[model samples]
Target: MGKRDREILKNICIESVAAEGNALAHVNGKTLFVPLCVPGDIVNVQVTHKKKNYMEGYMLELVTPSPMRLAPFCSHFGDCGGCRWQPIPYDKQLEFKQQQVVDQLTRIGKLDLPVIAPIMASENTVRYRNKLEFTFSNSRWVPFEALRQEAGAREVPPSPAPKAGHQSAPESAPLPVSGSAPATQLPALGFHVRGRFDKVLDIETCHLQEEPSNAIRLAVRDYAIDKGLSFFDLRQQTGFLRTLMIRITLTGEVMVVVVFAHDNPEAGEDDAARKALLDYLQHTFPQITSLHYIINTKRNDSLGDQEVIHYAGKPYIVETMEDLEFRIGPKSFYQ
Candidate 1:
């Protein structure tokens, strides 16, 4: 084994934050790994293991701090795992991410690269995500204890109606129910917790996505649950609904695709269900221009082999940025 392969703890000053949100520091003839650290942070790290040309370590303590550090927005910041740099200021995070990209090109790519250009800032840092996917899990990861209290109130006994003598509280119409159960909460739509697919974290609002995207996500989940659709089990890979995909254009056009694991050639396609989903989406969100449905019998997450058998409108959506216009289909990659 090479000398660098031996594990050794060391104190090092962090130079900058890396792309995956780990702090970067070079020890005496070794590399170190520190989590939740940013640039200009002087820390003491304990080496966990040694690699051929580098070392892996955990942050033991911080000696100096970076001015760019800021409080993370999400309550599940370190635990939930969807975002890595939420604690760092957005502008500073962008700078660090860009620097990491440039460093990879120069140091790892071994190319005589030119001076890196400034990073292009996203138009809407909040509510900018065009796509999101959520799963139906038996258990949920509630960020705080207060969320449980709110959920319990929905199930508890109702308060008495206002007395006849007192001015009656403004009467509110009852919420429509699908099938037998009331609608599920909206913020409950979210990604799986880090390292735990069976456990889902309920995100009340995500700043990354557009507003309509959240509405569509909640609606689809409600529809599927009402129809008694089964959510996919990642471990067993057996279920009716495997994944939900949403595509949106810069011009506000929306397309939704729901993937199923099994195909019912005999049952054929359910036109009514398709129409209901499409109609609900169109009526609720007029910005949608197209919608599609895909079925995949494969046991894995790869969507390459999936067949898109149905489409509601145009097969693709167009996005415009500056003078460039790009055509995006169900399988197109985002810029």
Candidate 2:
């Protein structure tokens, strides 16, 4: 395959944004993957890399705006990387996404299926997300360029520390430091950083899930950090806490799954830590009807092997959709 590197600024009209967040466009008989673009948008894109079959680009300017465009509700719209269609009106975004699925199925899948139909729009656009996973790493937090520019004149500095090894000055010894600076405010709750899992943008509020879902995520993150719980590393497959999974049902039932790379002293040490977490969740968030701990020993991404050894409530959470009740375990898929 031939590859070329060029900076070609052209008026690229986006047909749709793929599921993975790449805006698809046909440029000079070659497919282009443009970032931060939506369907119906006429943008000035700079081709950064080129291949025999496709090109990759960055949006240079918005030459012609799409009527579907709207002011994103989230302040961290471009930065969080969770909801790429936030800029496009929610209804329009769903319409385009459905169209994208139909296009790909007909074009790539080559399946002579029936005419693609419109997707059933989500009932609650904001706070509809029932699951969220946040990563932790010792790296700098970088927001999207657009967000940084918008917050140009107004930048807030990091909060002042309470001094190392000193929790309350003439009182406690800094709360017994355990793991890496206490997580420093759960890294954004929205989505993974583009092309980087270790990096995450802080999402203040998201409109994709229930409001309580976000609140529970942030609260749990803070609680874990205060408890000095470690976040897991997917690349290295090391860390005390690998990931946090939250499951909620239409009946206002909540379930939390705390996954670990390996067992911790609390969980392993007579299951004290695990019990404590369950107790806390039950006491603090009475809405939580189920809680589980998943221990993943494998060094791969297939979570199917991971087993739930402990449970605070029922083994699975039941979600009702289209008059069908789906039983979701700790290792189940959202869809």
Candidate 3:
């Protein structure tokens, strides 16, 4: 740790929420930003970074919980880097967002604009998104809670090098473990951790998408783990499974796109495991209207220029928007 890491500010009161969802405070004329903290919270923070005009830190202790703060609904709320304002009520969130717009236009820009309209509220908060993308990672990010639990436990062994094929050997490999030692590597299938593209948080459930989305993701992950399928390593750019995309339309249509890394014939790439996984998905999820797969060999996870092969079901799904029918292909861009 550096000098800033050892500096702990005691009893700092968070005055407001900043634009980036950090709790804001003023200490000795310099602005202090603390993450995972709500306004009116009195917290003890360990300063991570410091500058002349600003300082940023993570909360070490919540000395006083804000009355306006509500319990976050998601277990991975603070760590996952999504839905940061979940502690604030929906009405308060709307108000804050409106104030943000007013401040940005009139106060910050010095514009002589008329009163801005109130922001529209969505009917549903959870499970309202039409699409979600999940990344497959060989190194699963170990949560702090798990680390704490395994503080004095035995050191976990590092994951073996993944083969170039679909399924690796040693099918009976022990399940991944978490520990304080540095050798704790695990396969994960979920969203990437905030600021760290190389590590992925192993998500058990995500509330952003509807039922079938979570079910399908979990099923795929479980099967992959059981079959010793290699997850794509973001840093090394190896392994088989790359990404999973699920799209659900209001017109009762579902589309699933499974992206696999390039097959290496030199290292004996097994196509049978890939076929088995696709067959399992097709047989299990009959509701999936369109199923497609792409072989993305590029270093980055972009499929814009890649060809999308239809594995099963229809090649495209239909979405109806007020009598405007749109055919959504694997590469189509829709909100």
Candidate 1, 233-312: lDDT as tens digits: 55676766666677777787777777766766566554455556667766776776777777677756577766785556
Task: Name the candidate that leads on TM-score.
Answer: 3
Arranged by TM-score with the best first, the candidates are: 3, 2, 1
Q: Model 1: which residue pairs collide?
A: 127-207, 127-209, 129-208, 129-209
Tens-place lDDT digits, model 3, residues 1-335: 47423466778999887787777899989999887788888877767788989998777677788999898898777667578889888888888888887889888899898867788998998988888889998878876556644656854444444334322223221122322225656688888765567778888889998879999999999999889998998889999899999998888789999899976666555577778888999999999999988889999998889999899888999988897999999888987
Model 1, which residues run further than 4 Å from truth?
1-14, 26-30, 41-65, 133-189, 192-200, 265-283, 323-326
- The per-prediction CA RMSD against the true structure, in angstroms, equals 12.8, 10.8, 9.1
